[model samples]
Target: MMTLRRKLTFLVALAAAIPVVIMIGLTLKAQENLVLQAKGELNLLMRTNLAHIARDIYALCDTVNDVVAKDLDMDLAAARRAMAKCGAPNLGVESADWDAVYPLTRQARRVPLAKFMLGDAWLGQSRDPAEHVPVVDEIGREADCVCSVFQLMNEKGDMIRVATTVLDETGRRAIGEVMPAVEEDGSPNEAIAAVLRGETFRGLATVITNRMFSVYAPTQDANGKIIGMLCVGKRPETIASIRKAISGIRIGKDGYVAVLGGKGRFRGSYLIAPKAEDEGRNLWDRTAKRPDGSEHHFIRSMVTNSVAGGGRAIHFEHYPWPKPGVTGAEIPEKTGACIYFAPWDWVICATLYEEDYHAAADKIESTMTSLAVTLSLAGLV
Candidate 1:
C-alpha cells in the first residue's frame, strides 16, 4: 500500500501533467491554425500587389490608345499587319531608305505632328502664362495623372514629348529628344523593340533612373503603316503605396514582406525589403547553401513554385538571410511563404523565424507549469 505522502505525490504529479498536456496540445493546434491563416493572408497580399502593378500598366496603355484612336483616327489592326512586314527599323539607315518605306512628307501632312510642332513653337514664343497650344493641350489634358509621361515618337523612334506630367531635373518637359535605343542597364529595350516592330508592348522596363511600368503602342499613318509609337509610362514609385502599406505587416518579431522581380532584365532581383542593402540584389545567385552542403537554389525554387501555382502560397522553406550590418551571421531558421505575381513578374514572400513560434509555445508551457505547481501544493496540504 502506498503511504499518504506517496499518494499525495502521485496526485500532485497527475495534476501537474494533465493541464500541461492539454495546454501543449492546444498550443500546437493554435500555432498550426495561425500559420495557415498567415499564409493565406500573405498569398492575398502577393496577388494584390501584382494586380496593382497590372492596373498601372493597363491604365497607361488605355490612355495612349485612347489618344491615338480619338486624335489620329488610325486602325490598330491594320497598323499591326502593316508593321509585321516593315522589319526592324535601322536607326542608322539613310534618309532615302526612310522616305521609301515611311515617307515623312506624306505622314506630316496626314497626321497632327506639324500642328503639334506649330503649337510647340507657339508655346515657346508665347508670353501668356495660361496660353496652351492646341495639340499640346490635348495631350496634357489626357495625361490626367501626376508623374505620367506621354510621348509621340517618329518612325525612327525619336520621341517628342507633346505633354508630360513627369519633369526632368530642370523641371521642364524633355521635348524633341531621341529615345535611348537601350535601357539604363544597357540592355536592348523590349518595349521599344516591340513598338518598332509595329506590335504593342506592355511590360515593366527601366526608363532613365526609374524602373517604370510602361506601355508602348504603335501609331500608324493614313496608309495603315506604322509610323511611330505612343508611349505612356509610370514610375513604380507611384504604385509603391501598396508595398509601403504591406511592408509594416509583421509575422513574429523581425519577419516582414519581401518583393523580388521575377522577369525581364531585373529577374530574380529584389524589389522591396526591410533591409535597404538587400534591395536590387540578385536573390537567385545570392542564396546560401543547405545544411548538407548542397546548393538549394532558393530563388529558382521559389519562383518556379509560385509561378506554377499561379501566385498561390505554395510552400514554406527554410530561408537563410544575412543579418543587416553583420557579416557572416545569418538568421538561424527562418521560413517564408513564396508567391508569384505574373503580371509584373514579382515574387512576394512573407517570412518569420521558427524560434518565435516555438517561444510562444514555450511561454504557454511555462505559465501552465506554474499553475500546475500551485494546484499540486494545494492538493498536498
Candidate 2:
C-alpha cells in the first residue's frame, strides 16, 4: 500500500475523478437553469395562446353586440305573424303558441313577399307586411360583415340559424333546426341555458362539428320581456395553432408537449392539439401506475393545479408510461409542467425526462470507473 507506483496511480485516478465530478456538477447546474428557463418560456407560450383565443371570442361577441344594437328592431306582433307563416308548412302549426310566441321552424324559409316585408307600403300590397324577413336579413348581413356565426332563438327555447356564417351539410342556412342548448353528445350546456335565463353567456362551445369561442346575449322586446337570444361565435383555431407550434419542441428523446381537456367528465381527453392516436383516450381515468407501483393520477393533478392556480403552470414529476404509439420501453422518469386555458377548458403540458438533465452524471460515473480500472492495471505493472 505504501509503494510509490500505487501512490502515483491513486493520485492519477483521483485527478481524473475530480475533474469529471466538477464537470458533472457544472453541467447539472446549467441544466437546472435551462430547465427553469424553458418552463418560463412554456408558461408564457400558454398564456399567449390563451390571450389570442380570448381576443377572437371577444371580437365575435363585440360584433354580435354591435350588430344587434344597430339593426335589431322587431315589432313583436308582426314578427310572430311572419315567422309563424314562415314556419307553418314545416311545424304544422296552424297558428302561433298559446303565449302568442311564434314557433320558429327548424330551417329558415323564404318569405312569400320579401319586398312588402320591410313596411314597404310603397309596394301597395294590401296584405300586412312580414316583419320577420327584414330582421332576419339584417342579422344575416351583420354576420356576413363580421365573418362570425350567428343564431337567433325564440323565447320558447327554439333556436334558428337566422343569419350565420355557419352552414349546414346541405350548404344552406341551418334554419328550422332546433338548436338545443345541450351538445350533440348530450352534455349539459350551462352557458346556452344561461342566455335563455336572461343572463349573458360567454365561453367555448361546440358550433356544429367544431368547438368555438362564443357569446350569447338575451334580446328584449319593447315591453322589456326577454324575447330571444342572439349569439355570435368564432372558431378557436388558436388552440390548434398552439399545438402545431409546440409539436416540434423536444424535451427528451421521447418527451413532448400535449394538450388535454382540463375539466369535467371529459377531463384528460386529448383535444385539438394532441397526437391523432391520443384523441378520445381519457387519461384522467387511466389505471396507470408509477415505477414504484403506486397509482398515479397524473391527469387529475394537471387539472386540479391549473384550476387552483387560475391557469398558472404547475410543475410535477412522473414516471413515463406508454402513451398511444409510444411503448413503455426504457422510459425514464419525467418532469412535467401544465397550464390551463380556461376559455376552452383545456390544459397545455410540457414534459421532459429527468435523466436528460443528469446525463452528465452518468458520463462522469462511467469515466471514474474507467480511470480506476486503468490505475489499478498500471500499478500492477
Q: Rate the local accuracy (lDDT) of all candidates.
A: 0.53, 0.50
Per-residue C-alpha lDDT of model 2 across residues 1-381, encoded as one tens digit per residue:
489999999999898777666655655566566656665666455445444443443344345445433432322223334334433211111222111112222343432211211122211111112332333334444442212212334333545433344554656444333455544335655665786678866555555546655566655534555544556554446335544655555554656666677655456777733366666677775545756988877677766776666554454535455543666576456556666656557666666555554564455555555655555555444
Model 1 earns a TM-score of: 0.53
Show where candidate 1 strays beyond 4 Å: 1-137, 145-203, 235-237, 312-315, 325-330, 363-381
Best model per lDDT: 1
TM-scores of the models, in the order given? 0.53, 0.54
Residue range with the least summed lDDT across 10 consecutive positions in model 2: 120-129
After TM-score superposition, what is the CA distance of residue 295 in candidate 1 from its true location, in Å?
A: 2.0
lDDT of 1 by residue, 1-381 (tens): 999999999999999878767766665566666656665666456445444443443344345445533432233233333334433321221121111111122122122343222211322322232554333334344443222222334554544434334454555554333454454445555666777687877555544446555566765545565544655554456546555655566665766767777655566777777866667787667576777998788777776676676654454556676544557655566676766665556677767666666565566556655665665555445
Question: RMSD (Cα, Å) of candidate 1?
Answer: 10.9
